[model samples]
Target: MNRKTLALSAVIGLLAPVLAGCGGSDGGSGGEAIVVGTTDQYIATDEAIAPLDPAAAYDTGSWNVLRQTIQTLMHVPRGGGKPIPDAASKCAFTDRANESYRCTLREGLKFAGGDPITADDVKYSFERVLKINDPSGVAGLLTNIDTMESDGAREIVFHLKTPDATFPYKLSTPPAGIVSKKDYEPTKLRKGFDVSGSGPYTFKAEVKGDTVTKATFTKNADYTGELNVQNNKVELQPFTDADEMGKALDSGDIDVMTRAMTPEQVESMVEKPKEGIQLTEMPGLEIRYLGFDTDAPTVKEKAVRQAMAYTIDRGDLVTKVYGSVAEPLYSLIPSSIATHTNSFFNKYGDRNLTKAADLLQTAGIATPVKLSLNYTTDHYGEATAKEFETLKDQLNSSKLFEVSIKGTEWKSFRPNQIKGDYSVYGMGWFPDFPDPDSYIAPFLDKDNFLNTPYNNAKLRGELIPQSRREADRSAATNTFSQIQDIVADDVPVLPLWQGKQYVASRDDIAGVEWAVNSSAELLLWELRRGPGAS
Candidate 1:
């Protein structure tokens, strides 16, 4: 939502049909190969699309398939909750203690360029990420990887510094995908326009800086592994903008939509289904937030932060701005994952201007304590901006604070944030993994996820490392509860509503059930011009 390439949401430009309908397209009905339409274009790649380089991929929609079309030694299968294979067909804990793990590659598995997907390739891909050392450390979703060693042609071993129970889940991500050392020479920077990978589908047309497209994939008969789907072709058309995607979906441009749809778009699809259109709703990994620049003079006061939290009406924002599509978020950790808390609801259910004013007074915040809120205007569009305005009006009308709202494109939001340029800001997070650790890790720890440079003595010194020390993370619930308490009390980043996950598809587009990371993947292998398709 940080980039706005489409104006349909704001301008109300009906470039395509506006209606909602649904049914099923039988694979029984055949025509030319199905041509799905997309309203949004794939976000252009600065180079070729390659999951080989961690620095090269992270955006959700565009990255998911590229992450898939590329292979990893092990993958996290939906519902299985365990690691399966792509490069490594068979794997085991040779040590029996689950301390050291090894895997054997499937013979004949080769890159699109025909290079054997060797253990050395697997080692190179990982060591290279450590070498690049991406500052954001977002790549660390699979980090602390200690060392990856190759045992000749078919096998690879992983030695961890500690017993990581979530190791399999880590391998399930795109950042952990395997790559060819021959193709990804760690010594030189990669030009991704034409990269090598071994997945079900291979790249066809790549418009660098805009899109990388895969046409049809003939079955990789060699890939007789644990996965679903039989079709040989699929299209991964992605865009940085959500509205444009809505338009593209509305227009007959792409057959499937990989992101959450706006309420208006959802309404349209609800009205139609047989004309190659449909919608799928599920819980998502992404969570939007209201962050406070902890470095700011105003945000440092606990009462001010609490006042801000109490005064804003999330229900109104959901009804008016989100069209009640997204669920109201009362806690930072969403229920879709696990062990989420309804702390905010427990604290403040209805908006109370009087309570906020009293808290402000206790914190010495006199009337009209002028503050500015910043967000990415075009990213989430008019709806997001409207919500911010509603929040601003709520805070200002209390007579204890004055508020202003502003924005920038996501392309520039990062740098400004790093500089600590705003007092209050709007932010969002799509989990890097499916755990509570993912929810807590990125925000704090002095490294600065928000650039606010927050340091909570309790969190950094206590809860974090305690959770990391335990392999059975669910057992660390008591620690996370304390962490949540500190987070709520400190209020560096306040929890906002969680956006619902949605994917609008032409019934023919199959194989996308809820992904662990909450992505909608349309691999050609899982689809054919089937029932309820356009």
Candidate 2:
């Protein structure tokens, strides 16, 4: 099946409406402005959004905003799947071993503030992200880079420590977004809401009560990129609650709702068909999993981790907690990606109590092992409580374990998880870039974002490094296969389920289906208020 076919199959029989380009009651060819609603208040809440400076903005909300305002050397094209030149006229590996990369800037390139974009700007942008080196920042993605050199005003070259074919893909992310040295401080982070960028949109933000309540994005006439703005003006609004956002969508307060809408919300909208609202489902690379801190007394034993993985019923978790909105995942890499392998499923076919028991016996573990599982309530969704409860019930049913469940908000949860306060915890990953390496490297690296005590030399030293050198993604499948087998054996983390992306908008919105871009950032430029839209 083709990509579109595969994406449609995950929508649970709502494929026809999405594929037919169905619009809401108030439908038109699209010319009016739009208000996009999101339950993702990370930017508004100030709890997750770090410094908005391109170098320090690592969270999803900050990146979503930056991706629109700042132009990167290359970007995942709108609706198209591959990375393509955005700020650069062209970009490619210059060396035979893929250690060097070069890009030539588009002529007459200028920032929104009218500063000339040059090779110097490109070099400064990358070096600054590395220089700031915020612990939470995404500079780690550029660790392979040895140095950057400017050929002239228009061309820049990158030298690498080792052969890395995925370097260009890393540059396409927000951390590599080119910034004007004339506007931003080279060493210190740029503060305040004022942003200087060169992309499809010029952002003007409004901060109210420590949250970005509204962001007004105007078209950048100076932008020299692939994005063609359909709507002249777009306003992004944040809601503290999904129900509030849902009401706004139904009341025509917002033209579209993009992120953090729970499965229950989507199902409610689909079943009742809210008068003017329609749902568009896209293929998502979001994977939810359980991480085991190998240093934790309860899970230090590999058998305990394997038993937890073998005992939980993924089918029931998806059906009961996720309501079929998500599919059970068996690999760290989402199945949609080319390098994915169902190693976990192959190793442990189903929830076999006998097998879990045998594994525990082999490791000399006593029965009724005490386990503490931690999760965040506000971060994931309201359903997360039920999800953990269901998981606790499953493990307790095995009669070999006693589980304690703890819940906290994301603000406290993140720092505590990083401090290794949780014995076992749940994590949901939205990829930094669409690659198998993004899944493997960040999660297993010695100083992983999760801060779990997980270490596999073969995976960290050999398989991942070997896979990074393969220019052809398909040829690296063997390396990814080995990585997955190792992940299954180590049992540091258990793959749970992968979610399907859902965007709900009023029927009059014409481009709702295309709102989610290849990098999984919601493109507000794609949305337009249709002819009869409220």
Candidate 3:
């Protein structure tokens, strides 16, 4: 990374208080140890990882855990860099056009059942995904793929219909995970007990929502370090709440805890050291925002939307609700990354309730330009209600508008936001892929999941596709910066803050440190029960 990139990392370091000196206890108390806790329950989201076939995969919280068990064709590291091979042994570009590509497979690789890994499996993964055409289908990744054929028993070549420079990086995403061709048949799907894959770890059992899911890794005796990180074994247990996760970690019931602990939780843990708890920090790609549904009649008026944007006190929200663990965001792109520009903050800084009222008055907003605010009840935390409550107070007290807040579970909150259900809502995005494109395309792209029936001719016509179509991404930086400014002026989806990825692990569990991308997916190989642990 250049100085600019390094400086960005430093800024993130200054902003990350979520996991700074975080820990509640040490590991190992002898009673069925190695439990893990999360904020959400596992819902059927991934077809490969979901309980049944015929379902599609989307980047949901529930699917995150499952994707870890299944290996993707490639994975992007935390810091800014190229994609690394995860499933395939070696992938290369065949045509100079950056369209056609071929990937060589690793020899002697076996699934949990010892099925030989082949190039056909790689071909089937994406083709089958397009065949199902799941509503949230990741077909966008394969836009240039005309056909995928095996060059040899161990090699696969993807012939593209157009020049697609991003194909290599796109293949690295989880949606592009290699599936077993034998397991996946034309007439049926593989979603049930046939959950098998060739990874460093094997899924022994998955006890749905309870405290039991064991993935045993016997060092892959046949493996010669295709997977850089390898562990003796892995044990996973899921807990639903932060309090439960924290208590479990505190009492040495589990090896690690996450998302469950709030900013205050870290502070408390840091202040009073517990037995086996030790906290460390890593960078992450998580971004949280307060989305404004422009489809709402009231918000369609730029003045009202601008006022709503201006009225929000992002700093106070960060300090009060997030316990200073989050940093204020000005655009959809996060500050830690290069594509980010503080356009929103530059335009709308320091919640100015007085100016917000003036803007509403100048726009001649009539009595009760009422707005329906929505949020996910269980996803963020107990304080989520209070955050929106604060939003309601600021806007209502500004006399610009009246706000009514409602809460729903995440499962509902996701689909509704894509459908533009409420006037405004609070939702966060953990990048499906690490690229800046991940953030911009998902929300602003007209064809994306957040359908956003938006007609931003400028963004759609120029900024996005232009960048993706070109071979050199840096050439499009100016266009993206322009997009940021346009997005700031439009105020359709207002980004509130970006939170650092955090983990509250036992002090004994060594090597459980943070990643730059702050990838929450715990690599068993990177984690070992330390001398302090057992």
Candidate 4:
């Protein structure tokens, strides 16, 4: 098992108290039933749920609910690890080249509504997601699929356009969660929040008082999967801001809180321990960086890019702006993962103002290179303003560069960025999956997720494809290491920092520590009241 997998296994082991029925008994005589409180900022937005139908649900809030309420062929084990069989009895690549894959469904599988789950449903699920092809949906991840066919009553086969070792991992995500053909429309998305899924929980979403502030889930007794639900019910509360969520947590209105906490709030919680509150600091795979528009006149020069990379002090940015909630990232791949390489640090070393100035001078560039730095205020956090200001101060201090910082809300910023409206801009990524490919492939590929055009033929055409062919993920480390080195030299983007995952919960919650799943989604099934609770 990898470091992430091991960490998840450890978390699962810590749930012994919850699994042993310590808090499952009646409140009067034995103990109180566990109640989990979670916050979703995405749902709090105006366009609530983008689309609740699995075919169109791509946002984080919708995914969080879908992952629990729906069943996929494979799933990440509790406490964050490798993908194992869930709906399928066993799944593996049929071909030696890793192109063809197959999955055999487990016997006697049924949805929460008691509808039988069969290979036909599995085939329909993948086809429906592809046919709809919602731009916001994650169907792009399934582009490698050439065809999906049901082999028999229990077996399903996938024919891929390319050899993608990560395909199985993708199936464990919400995009691949199987939906009944009988319940869903084949061409269009099913409207409303009602769902018929076969996962551990039965989910019901509603917009209370004309706004989607809350979604509740009940444990499905008919669930035929690996996970054992510890709580009878889980409630997801959407807050407009972190302050509201923090207040709710403090007042015991919520048993647990995850995501949307500002860096300062996290630091405060860490500095002063709250009475009966516990925090779990897990390794995060999220990365924030500055992407450069290659076509932009200001940053078109390679030397200018290298100069910016060498001049900025990442160490200072982490300490002063982030309050040490994040660590300076040397590579696009986060340091927590095995494939990460300190390529930038190796090439540029610590902050060297003179070296940066000399590089620009040698390239015949004039002094005080003017560049506009664009960032999104609403998306990243209020601290993002401070982060960019610190960057401006750091670069301006060198006297070799003049910086102009601008901010916009995420909704406006994304489209403008994609249209190549910004010279140098800030962007953060949350991985779709845990694999190293999630970091490198999305950024470096020809049709990258970034608004800026960054196509490295070597990294995109060869290294990534080669790495995907390797069945053992560790063996692909060499390919990723080389890709990082190329990124350092090219300087298409300057990695700022990689964050650490933190979850705050009441100390009475024993299983709260293991709430996060392998995909980094918080699993309410793992949370239950600990010993000596009210």
Candidate 5:
């Protein structure tokens, strides 16, 4: 679930407008309330449950709310360090094989409403995710767990079907956020936006129909966790348009704006910001690409898919669609990850019209091969329309492919794509964690997120498992490199551009750099009003 479930760095832009002095209505010190604006929205209906529910939500917006409202056994440290304890007093692997793990909770932990948090709550939280198995949920991240057993009220042990060194990192994510067994149903998603957990904050949302318009968070006095709460209160306001969000930040309606902004907006702010405004830029791991259902009739031919890859011009996309805000990605794994390689570049080099024609000609396929490309109209951003149009233009220029593009809203787009309704669809991946396994396993494994008919025996059955067994993750670089090579050969998915992260806030806002982790979960507790803030 990145905004796909998303990741996080900093360049600062100081704007020139004369703001109403530091002593305004909001207050004059660090205790003032904070309002954070975002373009990310949370949608729930009878068809889709409230994303704030830990068992059902998988996207970034939902995860952000869950992060502040619930606590996990472990959490990734700021600036990309190893996961440290959060709910638990301590956690460790008990077996040399890395198959058995255990945790001991802190004494006298309580939820926001004074409910005691026991080992059973932790067990219930995880088992419900597996039991509900929501189509759009993060259940895929917990597939490695085989069983769990509780030792008294504080200790919980987990047994895995196979070795998984990345399990600790997975636990730090949203899916493992401990929920109260008394409040959350075992098999059904909770009906509304109210959340009760032992996190640093207690949450309440104002909903209009199926949409959450305003989300409020107050420091949870009854909670126990590793995070040091900074602000006494935080409010989240969601907007459908980036420009509108930018305007809110400009008018001082919101204190901090993050999660997403159009590249053009970022470039404009970087060049000439309004007075009293500051913008920060950081390295992001969000990758957008084209996914092909290998069994779909239109894109079933391997040569056709390869020719489409050769026909795409990533540079053109960077220039026309994203400007200078994004980098052209050659591999599925972004450069921020360790084992990244330019396998696609090494093989295809550049967009070659001749090689594209040759590939199709050699396969005895007819020229102007007709294909339909599908993209989501709302999910990614406004640039997505232009991005896909650029893709269609590139493929049409090669004359080896005829492409018709269609756009759908995310509500129908995700489920339809999973059902294999589209031949080739545009999608994005935000890593579940900071490791290479988050990038590779979700796409290439037998039960991949794309729902494509792809299962490379060598890569999936051997290399992936072998890499997970290594306690030292850096030692598995070669294995990940091999996996990238295999993916480039298969061409089931075509790599597009990877984006950068941007957060715009008032100069008086503090902790913008530490508000988000490498894995992209928003840590609201890190935010506060700086000295001289209004």
Candidate 6:
């Protein structure tokens, strides 16, 4: 069995914890409010705008909060599947080509603040995303939308610029979250931590300076949606690091832990089970990757990038650094997604010193290619620094590269990445939705999310658009394979490892597995106290 399978198989016997620990505190009318601790900080700065506003929020950190507070027309179901109705009563593509889609608002839906939700609000919410077009926002995802029209208060229709089969999946994301037209302005972002939506929860955050220290979610009495809210309230606390978050869980300061926990912490929990803690493992779509600034001086040459790809050993990094918590990824499209290809492995196989030397020698580049690798310090996890050090050792051992490592916090690192300041940098990706297009389009397209100067004409201009034309996604496998093959040849980005999602929580808390979705958004309503608590 593979590492992921073993992790899941071992979980069956190890999850038996019987302890009457301190249950959640009473949440007035909503009953006991379950508290969840997370290391995923809600970041907003002059450099990168946090997803406090649905129009400006794009990253997973912001989406986690938005998914709970803001109601989208549709949402992905729990335990992994396609999206179903949430706010909308029914929705379907009006045209056979997938160019036109329509949704009918569910009856009697209203925002948390007592404003009625309507089709006009949905239209305004999407239009603002296109109008503001924040550099850090998810505006790129809405480019296909040519025009949207709302007929009265109950119905809305979308006309797409192209036949995009992935449009529904995009609707299931945080960017598509329906906002109150009354509360949010048309041209600018709606600032502050207060959220007004028609989802299952009404959110209020405690902000110290710019960071959100704590947030509370009260069950929305006005909510009319598919989710069956089990609890009256839920509290969220954001920690700066995983260790601090784990400590909070252990001390009963928090009831559940999600988003991230270091490999060492997970291994320790498995080897010696803690008294009241239960670890639940789920399939993760998050992938760590290295992106290069092709215009930069050091790694501008394609051969230099190719040589580095051949030298680094993903197995060694997973074994030594991650310790069976992660699996080696050879494709930009992870194994969890459909039509994934192992083009990188097929071309380069495992690490080969001879291949690295020949690529450099043929290009007339001298030995020991000097490189400075950049990474974000606080964003990914605690294991990142160690992961880079292991990479440095692997490249140096090949005798064809000399490397130096630098770490910057996410706020500073993001702007520098946008400006192409670093020759090579590391970043992690969590899919906006569960689709192969989400993996390919954001990196390979002309207007890429990375803002790096590595857009390939064939992949961007031809393959991507062709694949989108197919209404049945499985029919686009050949096009996806070709795209992956070209990506392997170009060597612009290198896939490192794919992570396995884990949620460690107190045994008293139920629905740990269902708390987080396949897209990595935390569903606060899924969490509830187990039977016989308090």
Model 6 lDDT tens row, 1-534: 011211112222222322323334322112377889888777556665444887776667778888888898888676545568889999999988989999999999888867888888899899988898876637878878999999999999999998887787788877788887677888878776667788899889988877788999899898999999888899988999999988888887788888778998888887777766778776777899999999888889999999988998999999988987898999898876667889899988879889989999999999899999999988888899999999999988888999989999887887888788899999999888777788888887855778768878888788999998876677788999999999888889999998887788877777776787555678888778876432
Q: Extract clashing residue pairs from model 5.
A: 1-4, 1-5, 1-58, 2-5, 2-6, 15-275, 16-274, 16-275, 17-275
Give stretches of model 3 more than 4 Å off.
Answer: 1-33, 44-55, 77-80, 144-146, 159-165, 185-194, 204-225, 353-355, 358-364, 469-473, 514-517, 532-534
TM-score of 5: 0.93
Q: How close to the true structure is residue 56 of candidate 6, measured as C-alpha lDDT?
A: 72
lDDT of 3 by residue, 245-311 (tens): 7777667777767664677776776676555565555565667776776767867788887887788
Q: TM-score of model 3 relative to the true fold? A: 0.85
Error of 2 at 358 (Å): 2.7
Please state every model's RMSD to the true fold in angstroms. 7.2, 3.7, 4.2, 4.5, 4.1, 4.5
RMSD of 6: 4.5
Considering only N, C-alpha and C atoms within 3 Å, which residue pairs clash in candidate 4?
Answer: 8-79, 80-518
Candidate with more favorable, higher lDDT: 1 or 2? 2
**What ranking emerges by TM-score with the best candidate at the front?**
5, 6, 2, 4, 3, 1
**lDDT digits (tens) for residues 119-166 of candidate 1:** 877777777766764544545555556778898988888887555555
Q: What is the lDDT of residue 231 in candidate 1?
A: 63
Question: Relative to the true structure, how large is the alpha-carbon lDDT of every model?
Answer: 0.61, 0.78, 0.63, 0.75, 0.80, 0.81
lDDT of 5 at 97: 96
Q: Which ten residues in a row have the lowest lDDT in candidate 4?
A: 17-26
The regions of model 2 sitting more than 4 angstroms off are 1-32, 43-51, 191-194, 531-534
Q: Candidate 3, after superposition: displacement of residue 501 in Å? A: 2.5
459-518 per-residue lDDT for model 2 (tens digits):
888888898887777778888899999999888899999887777777777677667743
Better of 3 and 4 by TM-score: 4
C-alpha TM-scores of all predictions = 0.81, 0.91, 0.85, 0.86, 0.93, 0.92
